[model samples]
Target chain A: MLKIEGLRAGYGAAEVLRGVSLSAEPGEITVLMGRNGAGKTTLMKAIMGLVKTSGRIELDGTDLAALPPHQVPRQGVGYVPQGRRLFAELSVAENLEMGLGAGPAQGRAATREEMLELFPRLRERLHQRAGTLSGGEQQMLATARALCLKPKLLLLDEPTEGLQPSMIGAIRQVMVTMRDRGLAVLLVEQRIEAVLELADRVSVIEMGRNAEDFSRAALSGAEGRLRARLGV
Target chain B: MDFGPYLMLAMLEGAVLAAVLALMASGLSLVFGVMRVVNVAHGEFYMLGAVVAWAVTTLLGAGPVLNFVAALIVAPLVVGAMAAAADMVILKRLNYDPERTIVATIGLLYILQQLTLMTYGADARPVVAPFNERIALPWVEWGDKGLSFYFPWGLSTTSYKLFVIAAAVVLIAALKLFMAKTRAGLIMRATQGDREMATAFGVPVERVYALVFGGGAALAALAGVLIVPIQQAHYLMGGDALLLSFIVVIIGGLGSLSGTIVAAILIGLSDGIISVFFTPTLAKMIATLAVALVLVFRPQGLFGGTSR
Candidate 1:
């Protein structure tokens, strides 16, 4: 489980996330929806400890905000940032190797083989540089790298932004599998279709604050409310 | 004397220069590649290696072979540890900001040089090579006696000089293996690719930075130890070494190890061959001009592609 309360964070002096609060429980996909510049990415960065935060960021019972950025991932958290920030110079297999170091000691081989199965394209290009991959392939590599962490909490930021439909469907299936396996999936997405398909719970943000929340039962009739709140 | 023997001699000298220069410049390139800081005190580290070698050889009072071997092992280790400490204490404090670190290293340069002067003195000192047996080289010519091979009068090289070239090749091959095969080397490459992302992935980036700084210093120190037998240790020798390394790094492309090696060879051979034909001054001028041309046309460097 991951919980953030009144989190205030941003680059030096200019706060982008102004008192935003959200929670993501295990075995659920909680999608964060917001317009551009509404601090969705800022909130994610704050969670990752990439930016300084003043409020509480707790993973399970542990205070995540108190830990350094490098230590945060060791607490069973996986992150795929806005850009597919793969180590450009490293080969595809090497990128996955990095994620393995942060993951559980048990099932190390199984985890690597499983990720390769999930993205067969990566297997074909195991020795190729990550930077040379196509946009869709790069996105697959990024998601696979994060999944290699085998985390209890996964944070993905705009993963489907530039991906093809088939790739997006593949990503949606993986998210569902992870959720079924009792992992908390906190996603930031712009596509309503994707949000509707993957979100078990939706949290909307406006001007860096929580605007509304809808459970899966309420989401069916909340489409108009969500569109109006998101202004999309 | 025939031009053939002279050219061969010049080539031999150039290989020695290139070998040492490659070791030193590779250190500079690694630091710049990973930490993104220009270490102006890199040459001082080289000087430290030579001075430390001298000190160790003198203290041990062993045979030439034993003393040289001991110095080879001791100098790099000592210099590497000192550099790692400096990285943590000084460069880390500056947050590795480019301009600030350059200035900080400049301060380090003077401090190292002055300290050596105060202790080691201003006089240049030579460390004896393990062995200096000279073997005359053969030259072939189509003279009155068709295709005759003769030993040229002055065409010879010492056994230790040959050892230096072999050592550099072995060291470079080892470095490549360490980088391409080991886990720690992978971590360093990860940090080099993206610092923030490496941190996000649970890499201890600060520690990696310190290790890289130390490793780079060790390489420079090793080069110093190798060259001390041929070029006497002097406090000011670092100035010219630093200049030549900067030229090689720029021409080879910043942060590219292969490029650095290629550029070192190009510059080193030109320096030797050109000096044989023209004045040493002219050779230096030509090298400097080459740098100017590289900067103007291929600003990204000869082997470099899109900027990082």
Candidate 2:
């Protein structure tokens, strides 16, 4: 489980996250939805210690906000950053090996074999450079790389952004599978249908602050109001 | 003198010079490649290596072979530790900002140079070679009798010079293997590829940077130790080594290991042969001209990948 309270973060004097509070629990996906520049990505980065912040961010009772970015992964937070940020020059296997360098997870991390089975396409291109992979394949590699950490909480920033419909479906299924396997996921997404289907809890962010929080059960009757609030 | 034997002798001498240059330049390249900081103080590290070697040899006062062996091992370690300390105490504090680190290293260059001048003094000191057996070089000529072999007078090299060449070759091969095969190499390459990604994956990139800086200095120091017997140790010696290293790195393409080696050989051979045939100044002038041409035509140098 992860908890963040009154998280205010930004670059220089321009603050993007203004006293936002949120939490994510195990065996569920917490989806953060907002328009462009709503600070969804900034929130994720704040949790990962990538940006300067004044907040109480705790993962399983450890103060994550006090740690440096490199120490965050060791605290059981696996991040799939915006743009997939794969080690372009490194081979697929090597990228996976780098994921292992994050130190050991609390329980055993996912093995190379399990990762290959989850993304069979990666098995065929183990020696190929990750940059040369197709967009869909690169997305798979990014997600698989994060999974390789066997993280207690996985933070993904737009895993389906710019992905094809088929690839989107594949990623959707992967998220569902992870949720069912008792892994906690904090996802920043734009797709309404995927959010409705996958998100156990939805938090709408507006202008760097949490505007509304609702469970999936509350979504059916308030679809129009939710869409209006999201400006979609 | 028969030109054939003389040419052979020139090439042999060139190989030894090339070997030492390659070691020093490769270290310079590695530091630039990984840290993206131009280490202006690199030459000072080389000078320090020689100084340490001299001090160690003097203190031990052993026979030539034992003294040289001890100095060779001890000098690099000491210089490497010093470099690591500098990285942590100074470079890290500067946050490795490109311009700031450049200025910082310039300050470091002076600090190191002056410190050595004060402690080691300004005198040029020699390190006796482990062995100095003279080997006569033979050449075969097609005389009237056909294929007559003769030992050309004044065409020979010291056994120590040949040993220097062999040692350089072995060390280079080991460096290549270490970069290609080790986990530490993997971490270093990852950091080089993307610093942010390496950190996000828990690589402890600052630590890697320190190690790389130290490693580069160690390499330069090793070259200093090997060549001290041929070229005496002095506080001022680093100036020429620094200039020559920059030339090698620039001509070979900055940050390319193979390029550094190739450029070192090219420049080293020309310097050796030209110095023997004409004047050392002429050889240096030609080299400078060649660099200017490369800069105008191929700014990336001979083997640099991408314009960076």
Q: Where does model 1 exceed 4 Å of error?
A: none
Fnat of the models, one by one? 0.78, 0.80
Candidate 1 pairs with clashing backbones = none
Best by TM-score: 1
Model 2 segments beyond 4 Å from truth? A105-110, A220-232, B140-145
Listed models, DockQ each: 0.85, 0.75
How well is each residue in B153-225 modelled by candidate 2, as lDDT tens digits? Answer: 9989999999999999899889888876788988888888888878888888889999999999999999999
Writing each residue's lDDT as its tens digit, candidate 1 over B1-308 gives: 79999999998888898899999999999999889999999999999999898998999989999999999999999999999999999999999999999999999999999999999999999999999999899999999978999998999999988998899989988887888889898888899999988987899888999999999999999999999999989988888888888889999998888899899999988898888778778888988999999999998788765677
Q: Specify the highest-lDDT model's number.
A: 1
- Quote the lDDT for A19 in model 2: 93
User: What do the candidate models score in CA lDDT, each in turn?
Assistant: 0.91, 0.89
Cα lDDT, model 1, residue A59: 95
Superposed by TM-score, candidate 1 places the C-alpha of residue B71 at a distance from the truth, in angstroms, of 1.3
Chain A only: TM-score per candidate: 0.97, 0.96
Residue A127's lDDT in candidate 2 = 95
Please list all clashing residue pairs in model 2, or write none if there are none: none
